[model samples]
Target: MPGSSLALLISPRHKVIHHDGREVPDPTKNKAVMKELGKWWALLKDKRFFLLVPVMVGFNWNGTYLGIYLTRYFSVRARALGALSSGVAATAANIVWGYVYDIKAISRPTLAKSTWVIFSVIMLTLFSW
Candidate 1:
């Protein structure tokens, strides 16, 4: 805040909108309602949320466990290179997925679920081998 030319604080006089699309009468109410949404989305809106949420849970859990496996299976140098390659591949995959979803108008949930299944199969095959 010391080096900023403009004032860092919001004045209490300003009006803002609540996340739920209601008007906050003054700046004082803004801080309380600035969150993305006041309530969680009903899963009924899109059936996909139910599936994607579990996939996300599994991804987080498996990813943490994967670090231990990687360290145990590979040499220090191999592990480092694997990490680098994985990062690059992940970035590339993200870009491709984004482009395909946006430009191609693909169904996001179907794509996500199918990809997860395909990857899981590949993982199981590799682990078994």
Candidate 2:
């Protein structure tokens, strides 16, 4: 019964539709084999997927450095408390934003770009000293 409100907002059950608009069963096997890993290389060779690598890395790098630099504004115990508060804030943000996005309070693509801009501003404010 936990998360039932979220469940009611969105159904986990859905038909899988292919790119060609055919409804097909999802693959039962979740694990990928080494042989199948070549598909990623093929994608990169064909000039796909690789473009996302930088975006992924940029977000991670920004978050890591953001934490590091933010802690500089605090003493030892203050840093620890700041980290704790930051973690709690992150959890609250995730739950609230997940619910908001699930209810279409904001469009997914717009939310994504907005978060990027917000984080960039936060980073600039924190680290531009």
Candidate 3:
């Protein structure tokens, strides 16, 4: 039921035709409808949304890699402590990021571009070690 409801909500618009080919519904009239639907689809289809997927994967991988590497290099207790510390560090970082976003002094696109650079640097650092 939920899946069907989701599908109904997300289904794309279809053009209908009149019988006898006399006249059909104007497509320009449907532009508003399509635009509304596109807003929902853009959650996944938009370039910005898709770009974040790989960044999230890389961030998670970095955290996991750091945890496992620390464990192997040190002891299990040390690894656990390191992981806990990393979690706290991530939370603090997120808090700072949220504050910047809430302040709204800069546009979102500017923030996103800066964040892309920061994410790239983080990934490079993670992979270099």
Winning candidate number (TM-score): 3
lDDT of 1 by residue, 25-69 (tens): 654545744352443444346676564565566667667777898
How many residue-pair clashes does candidate 1 contain?
0
Which has the higher lDDT value, candidate number 2 or candidate number 3? 3
Candidate 2 per-residue lDDT, tens place, 51-79, comes to 45555666677779867877777678887
- Give per-residue lDDT, candidate 2, residue 129: 52
Question: RMSDs, each prediction?
Answer: 7.9, 7.0, 12.4
Every model's TM-score: 0.51, 0.44, 0.58
lDDT for model 2, please.
0.69
lDDT order, best first, reads 3, 2, 1
- CA error at residue 107 for candidate 3, angstroms: 1.4
User: Order the candidates by TM-score, highest first — what do you get?
Assistant: 3, 1, 2
**Model 3 vs truth, CA RMSD:** 12.4
Better of 1 and 2 by TM-score: 1
Is candidate 1 or 3 superior in lDDT? 3
